[model samples]
Target: MGVWLVLAGLNGAMAIGFAAWGSHGVEGEAARWVGLGSQFQLLHAVALLALARFCAKRRRLFRPAAGLMVVGVALFSGSLYLKALGISLPIPMVTPLGGISLMASWLLLALAGWLACDHARV
Candidate 1:
């Protein structure tokens, strides 16, 4: 729980900073990268918070989701950032894998929620 909270807060802060830089400090393609990075950071922050509050009991998967979110943010956003710098990297293609991971995390979360609801009904 503590870790999740910290991650959520940290990621949120990072996202805000990146977004600010993108909007004000950088120009051209770099701005686009920062923008996307900021967006993913925000999403990662939110997901971590949700896991801390709603899925802490399911520690097995919940923790991994948090990590995946962080990684996905790095991969997806990182790629865009690199590209914006005009440096060609093979990593942008990995963005889809991150997307897949994110999708899995959401699906797992939904399943956990459903299980909880079903148990509550019993």
Candidate 2:
């Protein structure tokens, strides 16, 4: 949880940098990529912050959700950042995989909440 919080803070900072660069330094497609990546990274950074807090109470489920979110942000936003800078990965499907990972993380988070409510009732 501590690690996740630190990572979330750092990611938030980087996302801001990306957004700044995208808005002021770049143009055309690169700007769009940076803008989109920054948006996702920033949003996920905030989510991770909350998840890190929630993980303290529900380590079993929130931990994995946090992990998936970390990986998802790295792959998805990282790929976009790289693309904006004209670097291409050998793997063509990285962005899509990242999106899938992010979706999976959200589903897991929801499941954790639902299960916790069920346990509370019982």
* Model 2: lDDT of residue 33: 95
- Cα error, candidate 2, residue 39 (Å): 0.3
Please, what are the lDDT tens digits per residue for candidate 2 over residues 1-122?
79989989999999999999999989999999999999999999999999999987756989999999999999999999999989989999999999999999999999987877857557
State candidate 1's TM-score: 0.79
Give stretches of model 1 more than 4 Å off.
119-122
Report clash pairs, candidate 2: none
* TM-scores of the candidates in the order shown: 0.79, 0.94
Deviation (Å) of 121 in candidate 2: 7.0
Best by TM-score: 2
Per-candidate Cα lDDT values, in order, are 0.75, 0.93
After the best TM-score superposition of candidate 2, give how far the Cα of residue 54 lies from its true spot, in angstroms.
Answer: 1.3
